[model samples]
Target: MSIHLENFKNNLKLRLDDNPQLHGFQTFKKTLERDYFSEVSIRICFKEAAKTENLVIEMDCNLDLLEMLYHLQKGTWGGNLSEEEDLPPNSSFARALDQLQELNEISIDVEEFSLFLNDCSIIVKKIYSNSIKDQLGSILSTIAEHYVYFTKGLSETPFEIYVPVFEDTIPENDYTLSKIREADNQTKDYFGFWGLYFDSEDDAVIYDLSNKSIVSGDLYLLNH
Candidate 1:
């Protein structure tokens, strides 16, 4: 089945619109058609910033991977296995696994594939400052190395990097932030709360308190 591109775009736009920080931000999207898999690239830029120094966030969605994941979840890709019924060794699902391994140049077992499907985003950030950019680079690099599927990149002028903040690391409360700081040995100043695309049932951005709004022992949730 072909991927529903319009639905995906609309869902992303709705989530972006809900964020107060991104209230006046400009968004642009382009679809890259490919043989095996299509890619949808979404670019977001704050309107008030200078063109040269604008803080931009880019998200690239792999439609084929997402479709496969959807099928897996719906039991259409042989993901639903029962005690009485085992997946055929030479099934379509098995072939898909082999194809994925060849495409990514990585071997993935069934258990690993299940975990990989849960990690959906490849967030690229173009920040404004060098100091913060370097710090983020170090922090995100560590995170990417630890997580099997997470990736990271860093660029010069408008510092660009890939950051996939795990659910546990996202600061919903003071305790969580404190724990994160303790583990990373970084201050709260290093933690910059930005909008995130959570690709679950809600399909919304996880909005946390901005850096300026964070109090000493209190972390606020901007929206549910």
Candidate 2:
């Protein structure tokens, strides 16, 4: 999904503004566990070296984002981004991301952590390189490495996003879930969970969060 830094900031501000006491926006990185996964790319006109620099800037940018998130939630800035950062527009952590804007670099202004940031303002969070690159690794692990697209700010926090329907959430008679114990059933009737293609080998490996599902085909819910 395309990300708008201003949109995120505005939404977050609105949410935080409405619920002033709700200081922290806790978003998990468990999206990888869902069945539906998509690729993310930037319209970067830079070369390989630029890519490297972009990566570095991304690194610092995330650090600052996280530090600020933590501070915002904790009600203190402390000294999180005090060190030299590798994010774009090299500068001290304190001066990196302008609160006026959601992101400082915004790589192609592309975003992967969009779902997590939806309607939630700044909370305790961190952005990382490995996490960004590898956040979808688990999803890719189930499929071909070359088939997926990882985005610039994929991993915004060390925590994982919550699966829409966790294994623990699967209550008996839930309709979608039949086999409770080691429940492994695959058939044309599997229509409850987020329908995901695990590998190129076949369409049999429907994605379930670790074992749960992402409430597949619920794009309609996004409206709310």
Candidate 3:
């Protein structure tokens, strides 16, 4: 049976209750809030940006995004001996941006991101890679520069897309804005933004995607 994005809520909650160690993965944001399992290796964030609630869920299982990140962090770029590698198969570029944009800002669930909440934990994941960023940026830049020539003033110019990031490594809390400053002084200023993390495969991929997959870009710049 093909799975839709409308069946993974109860399964998520059940995991939280069954796992004793997942309480540590609890997080909150401007409009979304929830708990997660770090071992299962999943993340859920509550976002209120875009005038909607976004329960962003990501699994770092068989194709864990974190694995690429760790590998890239350790100097494993292919082809040029430098430059971070691209995202694994079955990932989404837009979804990647959603996670980055909400790292330290208000949460948001807009556009094509509202079909993630349900009673199940698994879902088919779309693949994507940021290695295409350079290519993507170039294409976007060119489109903007040539918009006037093509549209003849019928359309506005293309603009640069800025992905938000934090200067620090962690944040105060990973739950919600209301609880970030009060969670734990030690956990503060350590890049503890809100997001649910699943440590189990069964708890993450209810639809088919490996529950352990967590896709992330290269946090460390490559040398090649």
Candidate 4:
């Protein structure tokens, strides 16, 4: 079950066209042959500077998982991780995997995976799993939680990744400001922007900066 590459490209283009901020970006896809898993590489570039500063997303997955994503996106699969359950029981996709496991065609392990952005690329590692249930859970969870970051051009809006802090140890109004000041100093000292961090509760709190007492949301010499 290979990925439907053409469908993926068409759908992605539609998604990008719907967002004005994403108009500057263009997408290109490449397939890679690998012994362990299939690979689909999608490179997103700013239209004005297509040659350099491209953001690449590499998806590495086995045949079954590849098919799963395709089906999920197409709405052929019943499972939707945006629901409350981490892994929905009613998914025929999971049941099919279970059948394959029973036949010994595939063996599942405890799913372990990593998702990180570094050096202008986002990498989604293949989950190593022996349990089909755990593997399904992890895959669905990742898509539900982080798919937006991949679709949205994070490079254009670096502040989208900013986290705010409101700690009891620090004054309510000054917490985020203090953290930014600290980061600004580190950026000067290191000759590169220090990454932003804040209270865990502030993850993706992307509204009303004035209320948060944030005077500025600028990245100088920041690395992706």
Top candidate (lDDT)? 4
> What lDDT does the true structure give each of the candidates?
0.29, 0.24, 0.25, 0.30
Tell me the spans in candidate 3 whose CA falls farther than 4 Å from its real position.
Answer: 1-50, 63-69, 74-95, 98-181, 184-224
Candidate 4 residue lDDT tens string, 1-224: 11122332232231112221222122211212121133543333234533222233344544343344455565444333346555553243344334434544223221212122221221122211222233433334343344334323232322212111121132346544344343322212221112222233232222223332223233222112
Error of 2 at 116 (Å): 23
> Taking the tens digit of each residue's C-alpha lDDT, what string does model 3 give over 54-121?
23334222323333233323333111222354543212333344454556344333111111222112
How well is each residue in 1-224 modelled by candidate 1, as lDDT tens digits? Answer: 11122333332332122232322122111111121123322232223433322222232333333453445344444233454645431133333334433544322222101011223433322222332333432333333332222111221111111222213333465553453332232333334432233222133232223322212222221110
Q: After superposition, how far is residue 219 of candidate 4 from its true place, in Å?
A: 22
lDDT of 2 by residue, 91-163 (tens): 1221221221232334321112222222222111112332322222222222122112211123222221211
Q: On lDDT, who's better, 1 or 2?
A: 1
| Worst window of 10 by summed lDDT in candidate 1 | 150-159
Question: Where is model 3 poorest over a 10-residue stretch in terms of lDDT?
Answer: 157-166
Please give each candidate's TM-score. 0.26, 0.20, 0.20, 0.24
Best by TM-score: 1
List CA RMSD, all candidates: 17.6, 18.3, 21.4, 17.3
- Which pairs in model 1 have colliding backbones? none
Candidate 2, lDDT over the whole model: 0.24
